[model samples]
Target: MTDPALSELTPEQAQMAARVRRMMLIAGLTTGLGIAAVFVAIGYRLFRSEGSAPAADVTATLPRGARIVSTGIAGDRLLVTLEVGGATEIRAFDARSLKPAGRLRFAAEP
Candidate 1:
């Protein structure tokens, strides 16, 4: 209480110092909160995805040069029809094992 000279400052200087301190505190808090929010969001996504991907049951393979026209699935089977050099090839596949089960086709006439 007795250090009067050090405590004394011009009114304008005192006001400016108060404003600068407040600005610094507000800026620091804004930066800190922004960084904390980003970390929280990233952590949430990381923790939540552990159980998300489903196990798929089957796949299909076609000869490389075939151009697939359409594909569909019925019950446990996959039906695919494709064309190559003006010939249409159709095949059904077992959905679980992905092996060819049957074939049906109608070729384009020359």
Candidate 2:
């Protein structure tokens, strides 16, 4: 409403105008927050770099009949699943250093 109209507003009209103003204020704050979040994400990506990675030597020799089933990265570890003979073997390795972290074997119950 125009300034002249607002000056002659009834009580109910004034209440509705106040509600509309409050909604506009909330919308402005939400938009401002969304913009700030995008800027922060851009700054983080530009400032953070891993630099030159160190070369790590790791060699694993699987059994004659073993074959890799799947590979994935979880957190800081690399998960390697292999079907060796009749059992399922899962090996965890440190992603950065390529060091063997742990191993697990699952066999079917006959």
Best by TM-score: 2
lDDT of 1: 0.84
RMSD of each: 8.7, 5.7
Query: Model 1 over residues 1-110: C-alpha lDDT tens digits?
Result: 57989889899999999999999999999999999999999999999765633556665666778899999998989889898666888899877667789998787667
Prediction 1 TM-score vs. true: 0.46
Worst 10 residues of 2 by lDDT: 49-58
> In lDDT terms, which candidate is top?
2
* Candidate 2 residue-wise lDDT, 1-110, digit = tens: 46886579898998999999999999999999999999999899888966656887778888899999999999989999999997899999989888889999998887
List, in order, the clash count of every candidate structure: 0, 0
Q: State the displacement of the C-alpha of residue 78, model 1, in Å, after optimal TM-score superposition.
A: 14
| lDDT score at residue 17, model 1, on the 0-100 scale | 99
